[model samples]
Target: MTQPFLSIRKLRKAFGAFTAVHDVTLDIPRGEFLTFLGPSGSGKSTTLYAIAGFQDPSSGNVLLEGKSLLAVPSHKRNIGMVFQRYTLFPHLSVAENVAFPLRVRRRPEAEVKRKVADMLGLVRLESFAERLPGALSGGQQQRVALARALAYDPPILLMDEPLSALDKKLREEIQAEIRRIHRETGVTILYVTHDQEEALHLSDRIALFRDGRIEQTGTGEDLYLRPATDFVAGFIGNSNFLAAEHLETKDGASTIRLADGSLISGINANGAFSSGQKTRLMIRPEAFRLERGPTSAELAVEIVDVAFYGERRRIVARTAAGQEIDIRPTSAAMASQEATPRHRRVFFDPGAAFLFPA
Candidate 1:
């Protein structure tokens, strides 16, 4: 097998007695976009800092194309970084911000000018080149910061919650720019963010962190559609988990008894389960259908409320067992008048359901 482009081999860090990052091992191919996703203090930022040479790992190593980067200083590592803050020099113009790195390396004057222009254009900030960062809006300043980070043509770029400061719409706008820049430049990116939507939108794969350790590493679909653990199911998207008791397993599917005494078979089981073991059945909110299918399981729920949001409708429902759950169905499929406060049978394919330990 070919060697990986970037490798984090059991990388770990500690702050005094408390460990911030557990041993994290991930192999990233060249030009691949990977995000470290988790809540605050879950070690995502700490791991990124290790790769950027800001914090030294207590054990293990970070290797780029088989060369250890553990001993390299932050500035000498030649890696680019964009932080939550813009981190642009207020005194410098947008063009100068992109030129600073080139100037530090003493690149020829002509080369610096050309590279600055290219980077600014790459981020679509060429029109604001002469403006200082203080004059630009938050989103524009971030674009300037992105341009500056990419100006030096670094092989790896590290971004730590770069869009966290922006509003939802602005975050989405810059996310598109970031994706476009990645495709255009083929730069390897290791981005850190707690936003699941951001990770799903930008990453080729994701490393989900929890309590200083990596919970799982896979493509967003893998975590969303076939989560390996209960935590993963809860974190990736909106899911309704009903309490159940495992009855039997065969051919990769399991039979479970729900709290309402409903027998649901053919549910996907994540791990080994003993008979009568308590577990939870996870079904995505979008998986529920108002109409029944041949292979679908039925749930009796009373519609508590339904709110329409453009193409989809958010439903608040209560199961027979008194569990309140969320169901989001497309507006085109569910009529607002039919979704009044009345008892209804919701259908979901058992094959699409997951069973996890309670």
Candidate 2:
């Protein structure tokens, strides 16, 4: 196995009495785009800062290719960073901004100019080289910022919510650009963002953080389809959590009795849980199907709201137990179904539900 490019072991950071990050550990392979995803104040930004040497961790070590990064100065770390806000000098043109890092490193003038031009071309802003930051559009200014970060040819790139300030459409455009840049440069990237969709779209793997600790780390599909904990299941996507009590296990299947006395048979609960323990069964919005079949477990529900979302209709329904669940149905399916039924029935496959020990 190839050695990982970056390895964090028992990393921690604190502010006096407050712990910002606690016992965090991760290994990032070379050229991987890893994202730290969480809500605000979840320590994603703090972890990025620590990696960039802007903030020192209260405990643990950060290693780059097996070497300790403790003694290395921020500039000497050779890591590029892009902040949420565009941090370009007002007086400098786009080309000059991109050339700043190379010049600071005392590279020859000819090489600096060549590298700056190439970097500008990489961002598709070569024509805007002479334009000042104030004169450029928000997207253009951010492109300049990206070019500047690449100026030093850093092996690792760290982004802290760099697209959060941009409008949604522009954020998506830049997100694609960032992915392209990562591919072309083969530079390991550590991105921090609160948007789950953004993380899902761009990252090769995601580290979901919560209250200064990493709750789970996996590919987007892994986290979404098979969340390890209730927090992870709730945070990644929409889920209807049905309170259940473990009834019995036969072979590799476990039976759970829901609050309404419905028996749900699913794969065995692999985690630590005793018989008769209270748990929650996680079912995604799309897991349920509208069908008339004797084999399916039926739920009597009333359609409370309907929302059209182009490709699908968002149907909100209340079960007999008064638990609300959202279902995404295809437009064609919604159109074909009866609209006047006061009480509707829905069925879900047993394999689609996940049992979480409460």
Candidate 3:
């Protein structure tokens, strides 16, 4: 196999007695959009800062192609960075701000002008080129910052929660723009964000951080569907974890008994489980079926509440053991039913759910 384009080898960071990032290591392939996703102070941003040269790691190496980046200064590392705040020059016009990097590098005036115009067009900010930073909206300013970061065409780009400050609608809009730019430029991107949806939408792979360590790293679907741990299952999406007791496992399948004493077989047990071990079953809200199938685990539930969403209706139900779980059924599924059944039975495929140690 070829070498990784960017290799974070056992990266760690500490401040005084506190450890911010703990042995976090990952390999990023070329032209790959990898996201560092986690909550605040979860070491996501700290790990990104180490790669961007904004913060130094206490120990470990960040290798680009095969060279260590530890001794390189932030400016000389040839990495572009976009921050959460629009770090644009207040005095410079949008066009000039985008051209700042090339100017500092002392490129030819004609080449600088050409690259600046191209980057402005790439970010869809050519119309706002003449405006000052104060005159532009928050989203527009950030676009200019993006254009500036890519003006010199660095081999790698680092974005540190660049859209965190924007409103949801605007954040989504810029996210689309970023995805388009990544496709066009093919610059390897390492983006950091606390937003799970943003990470799912933008990244080719995600490294989920929790409390200074990496919980899991995989594609969005892998992390969501085949989660390595309960933290991954809970972090990637909305999940309803029902308590269960492990029965046995043969081959790759396992049997478990739910709290209500219903036996569920053929479930995906992602870990080793001894007989009668306590376990937790992970069932996504959309995994529950209102109708029974050939291979379905039936559950007796009391409908507590139902809310209508355009695409899907949300229903909250409680099992006989008083376990609250959420289920989402499409509007078409309920179109035939006259009224909400006070006592309802639901079914779910064991293959779609997971079992983890409690």
Error of 2 at 93 (Å): 1.0
lDDT of predicted model 1: 0.93
lDDT of 3 by residue, 1-358 (tens): 8899999999999999999998988999999999999989999989988998989999999999989999999989999999999999999999999999999899999999899999999999888889999999999989999999999989999999999899999999999999999999999999999889999999999999999999999999999889999999998888999999999998879999988888989999888999999999999999998889999988999999988898888999999889999999887887776487999899999998999999
lDDT for each candidate structure? 0.93, 0.88, 0.92
Runs with alpha carbons beyond 4 Å of true place in candidate 2 = 249-252, 267-270, 292-296
For model 2, give the 10-residue run with minimal summed lDDT.
265-274
Q: Against the true structure, what is every candidate's RMSD? A: 1.3, 1.7, 1.0
Q: Comparing 1 and 2 by lDDT, which wins?
A: 1
What ranking of all candidate models by TM-score puts the best one first? 3, 1, 2
Best-matching candidate per TM-score: 3
Query: Which ten residues in a row are the worst by lDDT in model 3?
Result: 331-340
- What's the lDDT of the predicted structure labeled candidate 2? 0.88
Q: Residue 81: error of model 1 in Å?
A: 0.9
lDDT of 1 by residue, 56-175 (tens): 899989999999998888888899899999899999999999999999999999999999999988888889999989999999999898888999989999999999999999999999
Candidate 1: regions farther than 4 A off: 336-341
Residue 316, candidate 3: C-alpha displacement in angstroms: 0.6
Residue 187 of model 1: what lDDT?
Answer: 97
- The parts of candidate 3 lying over 4 Å away from their true place are none
